[model samples]
Target: MAHRYNLNVFCLPSELVDTLTPRALVGQPPPREPSPPPPTVAPLASAKGCNICLGATFADVDEQRVHFRTDWHRYNVKIRLSGGNAITESAFAQLVGGLEDSLSGSASSDDEISDESDAVNTLLSKINYTSLSDVPEDGTLKAPLTALTWFHSPPSTQIGVYRMLFPLDTPPSAYLSELKAMQATVEGGRKWAMFLVAGGHFAGAIVRVGRISDEQDEVVQTRKRKPPKSKPETEVLEHKTFHRYTTRKKQGGSQSINDNAKGAAISAGAMLRRYGEQALRDDIRNLLRDWAEDIHECERIFIRASVSNRRIFLDYEGCVISKGDGRLRTFPFPTRRPTQAELARCLQELVRAKVSHLTEEALRAQDEAYLASLPKPKPLPAQPALESVEKPKPPRLTKEEEIVREKWNRLLDMVSKGRLEPLKAFWEREGQDLGGIDALIPEWTGDRRASILQVAAQAGHDAVVQWLLFDLHADPTTPVPLAWTKDGGMESDASDAEAPPAGSRRTAYDLARSRAVRDVFRRCAADHPDWWDWFGIAHVPSALSKEKEEERDDKKKQRRKGLREKMREREAREREQERSSEVVFPVEEPPKAKKEPPSGPQKLGGSSGSTDGIAGLTPEMRAKVERERRARAAEARLR
Candidate 1:
């Protein structure tokens, strides 16, 4: 026997089977290679905890990446970076100081340093500085310090100094009390004042707040006094600031505080000496900074000092501290306090800047100067009045033209009514003498511009159309009027057809074809064909006629079939009713009529001389009589 193998029982070696099997099926897969532990991610350099997006921390690169993707974190980041968010008072000061230090440090070029020094020297030269001891204590310095004229003055004229006495030993609390008292005093009079202190200097701005009455107020008051009205009279008093005082600095010294005084003022002096000069300066600067921060004024004065050769140089610069970023920016020109002489210069500059400063004398002088510069007016030349002339009138139409117009109007009426005979008669008389059939009639002067042929075609007057085209030999190619062409010819119902040219003229043949006048124009290439050529007729016959006929036949056949079906249904219903009635009535036939012997033989009329009696009667009657006679004869024979 030959060696045999079982096909179904074929097997592989154990190792081969193991290699072919999936890892999940073959015990636990080789213990996984321990996954290498995820690589550590380091934190970004600028990463910080997000205070705005609560619970968001960016301690590492991965955390920062995740946080940046959040909408809340992104929004806050944008607002902060854009400088739209308000900063704290301390942050504002720090930011401004840091910017200034950066600017100063970055000025490494010689040109930049020289420009800054020159600017400072020029500014210092314009200021008239006075010792603080020279200022009087009776509020005499207040006028110059708070004068609006100084604000309007030129930068040069505004630069001046006056001495003011500040008791240095006065505690910050005392200063606060004095400010409160001043505010109370002003508030009682419906006035407002803002006190700002910065860099150890104090500045105050005052404005009188009150209401003004309009004409309506007087009317309302009178009405209230006269009667008690249903509706309360409303008096609208407009609140306004009648006067404003923008303060200027009056002190001109590095030490803003006074160290020597008598009696109670002695306490302030002793306190200053005890604190030491540097310590005292630091404390005063801190106090002023705090006051400025609290007041939050748009305009304020800042006093800063520079030391050279152990001597102090004090200056006052106007500062604008925006509430948003708390950034403090100084005015370009720094000025010292104003002196008596400087006050006069400030007033002069102020007058130049305002129109209200124009006094009556100044106005008179300006008027005189204007008059001198102007050209002298000359007297008008005398002239005599002239009479009016009449304008020429247009000439009217002659009697002949009027008659022609009447005849043309009659022709138009005939054309509109499709009266071919009347139109022909009219044309024969005046119409032919005037012009050709296509010639426009002067009386027919409207937008239609349609010739007689076009009107006939539109009215579907086939006879008139034929007469105008073939009989009269009128130009069938004459274009239709604009109005008709815009409507794609009066005969055309196809709204989507191409519009006629701007002149909107179309030939008579086109109009006829559009109107579907089949009799006048045969269904040929020249008429309306599927295809045509310049030489002659390209196609012999049109498929339109054949298609239409076939369609008609199909419709007729369908109608006949529908009628036959309806007839058959009606007959079936009638037969069913008859069967039911027969079953219910059970009708019996009437007694058969007696077959009486025919009453004698019927006489027949002669046919002229011949005796053909059967010829006189119809075949049916003769056959009936003959049958009766034969039956009688048969009966007799039977008897």
Candidate 2:
């Protein structure tokens, strides 16, 4: 007979690895260092299951026969190698180690195999208890599996697969550690889930790891409408997973199914409430269906805005991320292109401010109007019309005028005669009685008022004219006296004996302006310049020189000439009185008369015709007469 080897010796279940019987080999054992042959199969029935041992056994079988079928053994075997759940060969090691240690301490008993089987079952119970302690409180092992869902195959496949749902909402890190541990013990590596359909019954797996990208898409590229508050928070939930296998091959496999999806966003640990899970799934599906459409809109925004060229301008309500240098900047948004909702809010605010401002304005206007309506004033009584009153005509100077001039002349003559008191008294009595003479007097009188003033141009009397305009209410825009004069009296000598006719020389208008009337000139320029001739009065040089010289010389002559006549009268009266004194002779002595008669015979001049008259003197008489003659001659010489 040929030696026999039982290839079924390799089969073991997760619950009873420690209670299996060791079968002896029929042939000699192979050397430790012998070359290994290619793996061969035995018939399926050659290995038989033992419920008490919980292990497979095989008798020798013909060549090309495989003993592979073991239902109880396979179920335990499958779970012991799965990656995500706690059922695995590594989990069984935990069960086996403790079981072997408990068996080693027991004494041999009649039911030793039965005790061993009971001990294995008890060890399996302990592992199950510990594993249950580690399951999440969410009641689903996939709850913490992150954005990736894993899938496993039935008996046909050795490893499982993984896939990333779009818009994923689980973290990637949650499964990575657990998967790595599972991959270490499983021959073909751990598989991840892809889909869970109709609850957990029909789970599909793709043995590849899938992952969403870490980077985010631009928010402006995603939506024109305002995103909900949950948008950014939701992005953290999107993720990806990889269907990976622990394999040693010429080339390593890709790390994840979504390795090419570099910019996809994902969330972590974000879950709906238990009751809202279905709703969340529906939302996710809808979002997935609309994702491409949303993405295309974002691309359109990018194209239309030309954000890269600075042509696509995004008007944030306030600040947003800066296009330059990836920093942030702020600017006031322009009025145009405001979002409808934002524009509505702004207009509401503006209307409120404007209404407030208008209310203030109305209050101010009302206050002003009320103040203005309080009180006012009234007019006073009217005065008599002075401007319409006719000026009194200057009293006509009768012969008294001539007499007055004469008296003035005579009084001045008396002053030259040194009769100063009488001259002053005459002025007080007569000149002062002429009440308006003060007004007529010029400022520079040269001690003779009329003569010097007569030659001066009327224009020079500005002070007098101002007094007339302001005090006397005279008008200035009237013709001068000369304008009416025909006989040149207005330019005449001061010695003229007769006055010009009332209307011939000086008119009231002329007199009014001759004085420098201020208000009169102002009023004339304002209201009556057209009424008066614009041409200035012509100044006659002859009149100028003659009036000046004649006035001066005539004044002096009048003073001296009157004094000369008075002096002539006084000398004439003295001569007449002297002749009368000579005519009334006084009587001489009688003896002198007799002596004169005798001497006269002796002849006075020795002429017979005048003998008596000439002989009247004697020698003594002749001597006396000679003495008188000598004295008289001396007196005459002295005179």
Clashes of each: 8, 53
Give the top-scoring candidate (lDDT). Answer: 1
Q: Give the alpha carbon lDDT tens digit for every residue of 1-639 in model 1.
A: 111121100111222222221111111122223223223334356755555444344667777656554433433344344332323324333333322122333223446445544322221222211112222222122112222111111111111111111123443324323222322222112222222233333333322222222445557878787643332111211111111121113643223233222232345544453344445334433443554533343222322223320121122232223323222222223434323233223222221222123333454465455544545433222111101222355557899977877777787678767798878877888766667777764634552645776666666777776676556755444555444663443445535566755433454444553434434433333433432231122112232355665786799999999999999999999999987864222222224454556787755763232224445767776666566656777887999
Local distance difference test values of all predictions, in order: 0.39, 0.32
Residue 150 CA displacement from its true place in model 1, Å: 85
After TM-score superposition, what is the CA distance of residue 145 in candidate 1 from its true location, in Å? Answer: 86
- How far off is residue 323 in model 1, in Å? 99
Worst 10-residue lDDT window, candidate 2: 297-306
Best TM-score among the predictions, by candidate number = 1
